[model samples]
Target: MEAHSVQVREACDRRAWVRDSDRSSCKECTKGFSLTRRRHHCRVCGDIVCHSCSATVYLRNTTSNVGRACQSCARPSPDQSTPPPAVYCVICLDPFAAQSDALVVTLPCQHAFHRHCADPWLATHDECPLCRHQLSQDRTAFLEFISF
Candidate 1:
């Protein structure tokens, strides 16, 4: 049974993938879409399927921690890749706060914040506000990268 399930999952993963925007109907059941019956994509195969035909699967291999997968691709395939940390400015409580400002600064940990907001906080502290990640190094590399 385990081997059979694995085969089914592998077959699903090998099926033709579709982008989220290109999906029209349920790939598995060929069900025509409606207002209530929304479309969902299988994380592994990227097939647009109906909610009833999809299952919530923990995506251990990809950046998304959890996502919907078709019945055939429901099996988990764990990998060693680490997901990228979510970017949000702690001071402004916004994801694109840095982009809104003229001057932006990114920490060594890849967390970004507006230069004006970060400078005051960084002047007395040596840690990130969001994750509390330590900032022992200077901001030369980050400054050079964003130089306009």
Candidate 2:
């Protein structure tokens, strides 16, 4: 048996962006988007944030590439609850480590992947990679917020 280790990179952008209609305020600042304050998605966490809440940070995947990242993701802080980039796109098994502008997507089953990987995969399988939950069975209703 041989031991192997894999490295992963966090994507700076998400292919399946949280629909503009879905978010009314910046996820970080919680400020409403206005003419002066526009909506920008954080490349790191795929969160919609206002300009003040967004930071132009160096992409973790590449040396020369830079992209917009959210305040929380720009630093290794205490917000571990905020999900990091997918370890690897299940379909391609490609680590996102060096991809500065990769497109990421989150399935209804709660699994995330690179969009390029998920699109073709879902077209053929029509089911989640890890859960095997059929996409056709997913509900149309979008829950605004979860209550614990």
Candidate 3:
């Protein structure tokens, strides 16, 4: 039989209609995919998301564009055991890369502090590293009391 004749016979048996313009037909159910009509594009793959299935994409290591991703791919997995980079001292503008020689003096507002400069500076004053909240005398007294 001719190729076209064979194809026509097959299509007739399946009773499937060809939709050239509409791409939202669900592959599983052969029905309209729901999410496509509401949003501009698929939230995940940037494809034309239909009503039935639009996925959100979430990545742990990298940031993603919002409002385009769908739910199936949302909620990125937990990150690896690698710790984030250390913070730098705001006052001295020094990067705190290691724990050694670094004094973790906590501020009154519960902010991280450096010991090298803050300890000596607090000798005569009691202010926060950034906000300068008067904690120098109080901190000194507390330290002196603790040492005893």
Candidate 4:
């Protein structure tokens, strides 16, 4: 009985494999191509990145394959090189640098929020600035403790 089940599973798997192989295509242009001829598409934007064009990205302390971004459309301008610091306000997704007071505060959760942005933010939500981890709103309340 077990042998019969295993044989059936193998047949099913082989069919699926063939189906996938038939569907394989170029990552960028989406034209049908072979692995030897086609470059991997970038996971971010699904752009085709040939061998010379692919860029490797290291994420989550792990190395993963990523296609290189083309020069003109590639992200992170080398000439205008800005620090790769987090830009969005954790609380509002607003650009952090544009705040008038430069009063963006980093919550213990490693999330940054505008001092004013956080006060009202805290009233409705008591989480980390970025991931919204429930924070100590009443316990030894410090920082921009909102009165209202």
Scored by TM-score, the top model is 2
User: What global local distance difference test value does model 3 have?
Assistant: 0.39
Give the runs in model 4 whose Cα sits over 4 Å from its true position. Answer: 1-84, 98-100, 137-140, 143-148
Per-model lDDT = 0.56, 0.57, 0.39, 0.41
Structure candidate 4, residue pairs in collision: 28-48, 54-68, 55-67, 55-68, 127-133, 128-132, 128-133
Residue 46 in candidate 1, Cα distance off native in Å? 0.5
lDDT for each residue of candidate 2 in 5-60, tens digit (9 for 90 to 100): 11122664467567788899989868898889999987677778888886554344
Look at candidate 4 and tell me the lDDT of residue 128: 61
Candidate 3 is scored at a TM of 0.34
Q: Write the per-residue lDDT of candidate 1 for residues 8-51, one digit (tens) a residue.
A: 12223424668656877788898888898998767667777998
**Once model 3 is optimally superposed onto the true structure by TM-score, how far is the C-alpha of residue 146 displaced, in angstroms?**
8.9
The Cα error of candidate 3 at residue 85, in Å, is: 9.9
Task: Give stretches of model 1 more than 4 Å off.
Answer: 1-17, 20-22, 75-148
Best by lDDT: 2
Instruction: After the best TM-score superposition of candidate 2, give how far the Cα of residue 50 lies from its true spot, in angstroms.
Output: 0.4
